[model samples]
Target: MPRCIPIKEIKNTTEFARIVEESPEPVIVTRNGREAFAAMSIELLDAMRMERARAELYRLLDEAEEASRDGRVVDARDSIKRTRDRYGL
Candidate 1:
């Protein structure tokens, strides 16, 4: 289980850093007797971000496949040119 700490505990920077460094699980910061946010290592954060990005890419690919099946797809070169023209690139 993750460690829970009050918002006030964040005031002690040294202690907070120690807890984060020593704990493998994420630290949950609570406020007003409610769960607020989680503090996690950069490695964990980066992995989560990469997972989300892969999921998003898969979703876009699925949508593009559906569009292609529906004969609503555009040529890649024309699409790029149109995008460049639209954005004044």
Candidate 2:
């Protein structure tokens, strides 16, 4: 079950950090009986970022495939040389 905590109970900003450290579960903060904010650890944030990146990559690959079907293309040799020069590789 999702953990829920009130905003008033939070003594200060650092206290919230302590609560987050002790529990990995996401905490939902409420105010005036309404949902207010959410908190998660860095692990959760990193996982979310990785998931978003993977989704974006997949979408780009799909677009690339569609573009190639329509005859849009890039030169492999030129692309590789540009990459090497840009990165000093």
Candidate 3:
């Protein structure tokens, strides 16, 4: 579960840094009982980013599969040729 910290707590930089470094879960900083921001380990951030990227990749692949099933795809060679011509490659 996420840990909620009041904005005032962050004033103690050493303690706040230690809390963030030691915890595996996200630390949610709140301002006046309202959520302000979140702090997490670099590893967690990278994992989240990778998860989002994979989700996007799967979504694109699904779209491609549906298009292929609908016979909306062109020949690979023709597509490559068009790209080459467009980019003067």
Candidate 4:
């Protein structure tokens, strides 16, 4: 389960930074007995971002494979030439 703390407990910048850096899981900050926000380590955020990017890459590859199987594909050399011309590269 996530660790939760009342918003009032975060009295200062030092405590807030300490909570975010030291918590193994996201720290759920509550206000008025209700969920307010979440704070987590930068490492955790970076890992989440990387995972999202990897998932997107896999999805794109799957789409490309499906398109290739359906013969909705272009020649690599021709595609590269078109890209280069389009970008004036």
Candidate 5:
């Protein structure tokens, strides 16, 4: 579970800062009785970003299945050369 109490329950800034620092889970900060945003440890944020990148790569592969089945895929070696040349790699 997330480690935050309601924004109303924050008696002071120190308690808010403490929970944000100590909790492994994210804390939802509210403003004007609505969710403002979440705060999480940097490690958790990086893990989430990596997971999103993997998901995007998988989506591209799935979309290309028909091209692969029809032998429309580019050669790996040619693709690598094209990419390297495009980027001056």
Candidate 6:
């Protein structure tokens, strides 16, 4: 479960920093009884970003595989030459 904190409690930067650093879960900041923001450690944020990126990469790979199976594929050498000619590379 996430740790919930009122916006008012954020005024104490030291305590807020400590909570974010020590807690394994994200700190949910509420405004007027509704969730408004989330605070998490840098490591957690980076890991989440990397995981999302990996998932996206896998999705793209799957899409490419389906395209290849459907005969909507290109030769790597031909594609590279076309790209080079288009870009004057």
Best by lDDT: 6
lDDT of 4 at 54: 100
Tell me how far candidate 6 lies from the true structure as C-alpha RMSD in angstroms: 1.6
lDDT of 3 by residue, 1-89 (tens): 89999999899999998898777888999999999999988877888899999999999999999999999999999999999999999
C-alpha lDDT of residue 19 in model 1: 89
Give model 4 RMSD, 1 decimal.
2.1
How well is each residue in 1-89 modelled by candidate 1, as lDDT tens digits? 99999999899989898887777878999999899998988776777899999999999999989999999988999999999999999
**CA deviation > 4 Å runs, candidate 1:** 22-25, 77-89
Query: What are the clash counts of all predictions, listed in order?
Result: 0, 0, 0, 0, 0, 0
Specify the poorest-scoring 10-residue window by lDDT in model 4: 15-24
The weakest ten consecutive residues by lDDT in model 2 span 18-27
TM-score of each: 0.66, 0.68, 0.85, 0.83, 0.60, 0.85
- Write the residue-wise lDDT of candidate 2 on 49-78 in tens digits: 999999999999999999999989889999
In model 3, how large is the Cα lDDT of residue 55?
A: 100
**Global fold similarity of model 3 (TM-score):** 0.85
Candidate 2 clash pair list: none
Q: Which stretches of candidate 6 lie over 4 Å from their true place?
A: none
RMSD of each: 3.4, 4.5, 1.7, 2.1, 4.0, 1.6
Q: Write the per-residue lDDT of candidate 6 for residues 1-89, one digit (tens) a residue.
A: 99999999999999999999888889999999999999999988988999999999999999999999999988999999999999999
TM for candidate 5 is 0.60
Model 6 has a clash total of: 0
- Whole-model Cα lDDT per candidate? 0.90, 0.86, 0.94, 0.93, 0.82, 0.96
Model 2 residue 33 CA deviation (Å) reads 1.0
Superposed Cα deviation of residue 40, candidate 3 (Å): 1.3
Report how far residue 58 has shifted in candidate 5, in Å.
Answer: 1.2
Q: Write the per-residue lDDT of candidate 5 for residues 40-70, one digit (tens) a residue.
A: 7777788889999999999999879978988
